[model samples]
Target: MTDTLIKLAVQAQFRTRPTLRSVVAQMLTEHLQEKYPPLTLPVAQLRLALPREGGGRGLSPLVEVALDYLASGIFPDLTARDGLDAYLSDASGTRLSFEQNGTRHYDLAVVEALIRELPVIVQVGFQDALMAYWNMPSDAGGSRWQWFAGILQDQLRAAAIRQLAGDVPALQRINQLTDYPARETRSQRHGPESSLHAYSVQTRLVQGETQVTVQSSDLLLVDGKQVWLCNLSGRIEAYASLDAFGQALGSAHGRPVYRRQPHLATL
Candidate 1:
């Protein structure tokens, strides 16, 4: 089921610009079907920012990033409080975490647990699939699993608020916009330096109607704190962050106002 779902996704990557993976979503969906239940929706989402060879930030495969982060913390003995998407330590370690599934967000764990009861089988299968997806050697799969476990530990060990905050605060801030009902992806660019995604937005109108949209090129930046938006005139209309842009879009337009929705048909 998982492999079938993933196969469907290969084409989706091209169609969607960012490739989508449905393995986890499918596994759970199928498991639910077998259990006489079903997931609420078709669960494939996640635009893999497949990394380039020369080495750039956004280019690395997300799994590799998550795996590398976890591997950095792997130790001899420790237990993890499993996060369905990732994991963390029950013993002493640094504070960090990452998800093998490429989506940028998760329901807060406490709320998630109340919603899904940890579903340990999902964890077991997820670990197995993640290993296979990465082509991990069978003999060292245990240690590889431990690497993921170590990632959980590192995150669990983070400073109080930071632990719960996220893996990368800058990127995390940008992701919050996706949760808002109105936000939409406008465009995407893939190249050696970094991957760029543009969004179309209907900003707030405390006084007048203004939107958050931008122009782009082969290269762009999204540190999560700020996204640079350029207009047809080649002037950059900057967004302080995805959230700031979202609030401005959802609220009302103001300072350095904008209202005309840019033509995105070409994108």
Candidate 2:
């Protein structure tokens, strides 16, 4: 009865909004039904095979399976044949699977759980980031799914860093001064004489009726052989050394006077 209801719901949806993909999927299912008996798996059997972390409430496994079936038919190219699963497995630690009936499934629960753990501001920021990525021209990248996975991973990493550093006084001061909802700081060493240190910030501003959001990064490259300051105004300044960058930051006009003020009276 559950299987019959799910098929009826999907069929009704297709009738309301018919598309080439849906028509093809219907035809395929019909053709397969002629050769083999329909599988009547129970709802519990169709639930996500992986165990969820916190067991948070979300869409029923049956609904998730239905959506997965629809997505598989609509986006056939993103399946194993197109290498999306392989790319995502390596890049984002996410995997996609296929059921016996050929429906493709991914761990939507995991993604939803991660997003739910983030702060509201971070959630909004991630939405904006996704929209911007979606608006990019087709020629800008090869696979939209791959780019999207990358963006998700980046946001998750930033959010995790912010959450872990929430109690650190120095990081709190930096966050307060930058006015950025989320920030990521990292230092890495590569080979003998090469190193990199960077602070990336994300913020939103309102101008008239328009709201603008931007991301900027201050980077020290190759063990301070060079410094790059990317500002919210979309300006990039390159300096030969840390000292040069410090001088520019200190003397630049229109700089916030309060930034130079010492937080402690002794300083």
Indicate which candidate wins on TM-score: 2
Per-residue error at 226 for model 2, in Å?
3.4
Which 10-residue window in model 1 sums to the lowest lDDT?
A: 75-84
Q: Which has the greatest lDDT? A: 2
Q: After superposition, how far is residue 136 of candidate 1 from its true place, in Å?
A: 49
Tens digits of per-residue lDDT for model 1, 7-51: 454334223221113344445345433432312333222112322
Q: Candidate 2 on 1-267: residue-level lDDT in tens?
A: 243553564354334343333333343333323433333332223333332334421223433433454445321122232222212121223333547667554444433333233333333444555554455543336445444434433443343344435545333332332332222322121223323444543334444566555543432222345444544322345567766655554453774432321111100
lDDT score of model 2?
A: 0.37
Error of 1 at 38 (Å): 58
Clashes of each: 22, 0
- TM-scores of the candidates in the order shown: 0.17, 0.23
lDDT at 54, model 2: 47
The global C-alpha lDDT for each of the candidates, from Candidate 1 onward, is: 0.35, 0.37
For model 2, the superposed segments whose C-alpha errors exceed 4 Å read 1-141, 144-193, 196-222, 229-236, 252-257, 260-267
RMSD of each: 25.6, 22.5
